[model samples]
Target chain A: MSDSVVLSLAEADSLAREVLEAWGLAPDHAAAVAATMVAGERDGCTSHGLYRLLVATASVEKGVVNPAAVPEVSEPAPALVRVDGKGGFAQLPFSKGLPLLVEKAKAKGIAAMALNNSVHFAALWPEVEALAAEGLVALAFTPNHAWVAPAGGTKPVFGTNPLAFAWPRPGREPFVFDFATTVIARGDIELHRRAGKPVPEDWGYDAQGNPTTDAKSVLDGAMRTFGGHKGSALAAMIELIAGPLIGDMTSAQSIAVDAGRGGSPLGGELIIAIDPAGFLGDRVDEYLAHGETMFAAIEGQGARLPGTRRLAARRESLAKGLAIPAAFHAEILDLLQKGKDHVPNPPQGSRAGSNGAGDGSGGH
Target chain B: MSDSVVLSLAEADSLAREVLEAWGLAPDHAAAVAATMVAGERDGCTSHGLYRLLVATASVEKGVVNPAAVPEVSEPAPALVRVDGKGGFAQLPFSKGLPLLVEKAKAKGIAAMALNNSVHFAALWPEVEALAAEGLVALAFTPNHAWVAPAGGTKPVFGTNPLAFAWPRPGREPFVFDFATTVIARGDIELHRRAGKPVPEDWGYDAQGNPTTDAKSVLDGAMRTFGGHKGSALAAMIELIAGPLIGDMTSAQSIAVDAGRGGSPLGGELIIAIDPAGFLGDRVDEYLAHGETMFAAIEGQGARLPGTRRLAARRESLAKGLAIPAAFHAEILDLLQKGKDHVPNPPQGSRAGSNGAGDGSGGH
Candidate 1:
């Protein structure tokens, strides 16, 4: 009657693991991928949480994703590490490359990791937060399939293009913020359309470059970047730096290759990690302490740091477990019997592929 | 009859040089500093052009800037370069640090330069453009004196933090973008106030955290980030990385130190450079060529890249020369005769110094 089911953290984790493994993922990769899903749920990022399992299952069934692929890491340069995800999910490659990235960052003051050929479905905060946990400042970026347009353009030339950053906080959780450059997630638009509601005028433009509040029109057209041109510029930066700079596919290339498979965003992710001690030497503690004043000022004025909500959610969820929608939970169970039984909709208007513009992958 | 004059770029350069030399800057430092003002002029950025000369003269006369300080560089780590400006302008430190940064990037695949104890008065594009010219992708950030508030807060706790980036385009001008995290320059708002005009409602908030278009009240209060919370997060990132990571002052720290002599932003700048050869190796050309398609898509849709105007201005200025304001040019002349005769008002609000909220230093 409540239309929801409460499950323990362990149960949710097992559920995600089973879904991936059942869909043909190897045990090691399945575990690595499952951790991100569990973490997303624990942090109350429901959009990226357990719902992602359905998307992954769909991709695997459609043969758009390589479920058993092993991530391979190589030292492309002294301060650069390259991780070929072998056309698999990004989580495995990211985990494989973290050690080398952390090592190089510590040795050289800064270092970068380029994860290419991966299907990225996870939110980036977890990737950056992991590096921050190792006492390093981290910034990460990745491009989704092209769906958002440049500020003045009517057609899609850019992706949602998420940028994530984490700053180390010595005694507590790191400061973190990860966000899509688009005004809102494509999934949100789909939800709006499903609810038969109109969206904000600025959310997107139709094919004729006219502003529209119709969710359906936007889904069939292009999304706008947040913050106007500033956000648009940042989105472009993400596309290039994480795209061609890594010799991986751009969002355009990815979506073209996806061609309607409704798989996760397939491209490259660039992660830069810097060791503060490398720059500040023995004075790292002193300077970070000084940084506290700036932090205090933001909160003292009644504003919140971006990561505050996520951290709070993590704590509450860990203590009480995850409460997931009953229907979505049933779908996960159905996925065990038939991986294709529940497929999230594919993205719209970026050549919606065979799925015909269904909102698959939860969100970009 | 005309308020503005069309001066040859050389005239602007020479005028700037004479003012700096008269203010006690060494000839080498003066030449190095004058180049940025001239470049700003050439690129049609009048606010950062010859007008900055008066501000520099004020900083020197007030003893807040060390006009003759020589920048010193050191390599504390293999891929990290540090430049100590010794309280001089950032231009000198950036130049002194660039060679090593390029070398490290070429060797290590990526490198970073941290500039400390510098006065930053110019736009950031030049710094990144220089790196891009070296065939490297680049990113740069610096914190000015605190004048912006976090999106939901009513206090000035962050600088008009600027983020700059450049990507190489082989055989053509590199794609580039440099912008402040704030909605607009503090100087623009000052210009609005001086012109007795109301700014856009979202530009800033007044003392009770109410949205206000009154330029004076907003200036007396706090400016907003360009895109609400997203921009604020970026501003905070700029403060931490360019601030604590480099062992220099955060905007809050910088403003408190200023107590207000209306000097330039005294702080640190972080520059990261990456070599394409390092990532794509021999395939660099192939990938960069592939990147052209993305650019074509953007332009095909009638959208211009951020650097298109600057590139056009640079070519036009190089051919025809700079068009400077006659009033501002005459003010530079006045400064040479009496150091503080024509100081740009320091940045408004954020604790007006002994100068008493006079808009010295033009803007943050």
Candidate 2:
């Protein structure tokens, strides 16, 4: 632990936007990417924030991410929309297509958006939360390069596949959560390794298929699904639903096709939106009240609701500023300078211990 | 352990149906209930099989379950159907409405069935499996009486809500799984208590808000969700979606309203069906092939698919016989005799160690 640099939220967002702009991304695209990263940072999700920019920039330089790519959306069914990300960032497709998805759901009671050929690097909660804010129940699932082993398996056969869900509470803040099927996300393991901490025995295994507590060994081997078979089953479901169901790469396929681009895997995401009011009519209010009662009961019983802590952190960051490691801040400044010079090369060793590919921040 | 009696599946089904018929249930209604129970036994889910019959029959006798009730289906939206169960077994409504649901999904790419005022006692997998067998991707959720504590909470505030998912794999058994949000179902804990065995540390807590391994304390206090907060959040989502969203009772509400009827709680279920072929067109077979590849990889890695064991048990039971406790078999026979005598009273001490209001087998 060392002294950190405190940058106001606006300053962080502007700086991130400028860096992406310098890399030749369209202003709007840069803004979307910056907003996602800044939100992650504001919520204390450091792995999905500024920590990922260098790798993302490097990925752009390597042509793994098309800077000028535009998503193409099509309605295959009245309640189903498909967006081909065209090798661009996932945020672009989601941002451009979610409105239509929400509209369809509002009109049809339920709708689905399948996003394919996208590179997902940010946390998944933002997209789901966005949908929830529109007064809809939202669920999102995405697969990544295989890094987790299925239950009782020795090798990695699935991604730290992430699932996100959000429920709107009308006037109150929405309840949102995003979690990886793995017992612990890769970023958490990276942090533990950096801190020389031992992970739980069930978190992962060694190369030889034996359970290991060492974070470093687990990283080199494979992460284990949380809750054993239950979590693994969920991971598999995501792989099927978000991958092949959406005409994108499965985790195994992603691993086979992805080059060492030092960025997130190019894959797909499946998002579902359900309009509660459309289905429940006036009864929606009663549903919200029930949720409130449950929340109050949980709090009274000394438990915190999901997303409460993250929302608190976000509020605090908005009021004050984001805390960034001093060294990381210096590195960002260096990257800024390089960006000014039109140098697209990501600094070597900038992301030590990161699997040449991105850490799959969507799972974080 | 005592030796068990094995009865052919047909014999079990006929016996269950006869008992229900003698209790004044219509032949068709009795047949539906018997089929569900027999399927549970055939799949090795004894908790939901003959073990639940006494409570179910008692419910009919107490008027908690309307044996002659028929569900009314109304289409509120093109892709959404609301089914009023009219206070009866869930299977009846599902049996009547699933074809319509499947038809709607095929026409619109996705459809949802909101079933309210239903008593769901059988395992949820069967419903989702039926939909999957029709070449659809299906998800089912239901809430029960409050028995599980939210993460970090000291008291039970949510049900051991169960979620089931199924994916069709053409020409093969569908991939289907149903799991309770709690670490283990209440029946399992009751079994542990009866056997004088301790549960895992993470399984539950004592009334004093301290973690306890004693199954009896867990039974009296609260059952913790599996995977801590993640599972708890899922339970909460189910409560919102399946309860209030369907114009039914939330778990806490159900607990407050339900009398000691020695039966499964009267609640609601949410079923969603998606037509992959409708959305993906000719690409579905390719998707199925990808799933097979992933399954092969998982098997090669020494991992078993989630539903393999259940499917195997079902096949075996259909071929051989259903293994059941001799005492339970004799009890069912005795109940049949009582039914023949027009005795509406549930046998005294029929349920061992149940908390007077049944074990909420919705989670089983």
Best by lDDT: 1
Q: Model 2: clashing residue pairs? A: none
lDDT of each residue in B165-227, candidate 2, tens digit only: 999987888999899999988889998999999999888888877899999999878998998
> Per-residue CA lDDT of candidate 1, range A162-226, in tens?
99999988799999999999989898999999999999998998877789999989977899999
Q: List model 2 lDDT by residue over A1-364, tens digit each.
A: 3579889988999999988888866677788898899988998877888877787777677656766566778887888888777667788879989889999998989889888777778779999999998989999999998889999897988999999999888687798989998888898898899999999998898888899999999987889998888899989999988887766678877766564544577788999888887667766786677777888889997899988888898899888799888989999988777777874543221221222112222221
Residue B77 displacement (Å), model 2:
1.6
Quote each prediction's TM-score.
Answer: 0.92, 0.91
Q: Which of the CAPRI classes, incorrect, acceptable, medium or high, describes model 1?
A: medium
When candidate 1 is compared with the true two-chain complex, its DockQ is 0.52
Q: Residue B135 in model 2: shift from native, Å?
A: 0.5
lDDT of 2 at A298: 91
Candidate 1 residue-wise lDDT, B41-92, digit = tens: 8987878877788777767666666766677788878899988877777788
Query: What lDDT score goes with residue A348 in model 1?
Result: 33
Q: What is the lDDT, from 0 to 100, of the residue B116 in candidate 2?
A: 73
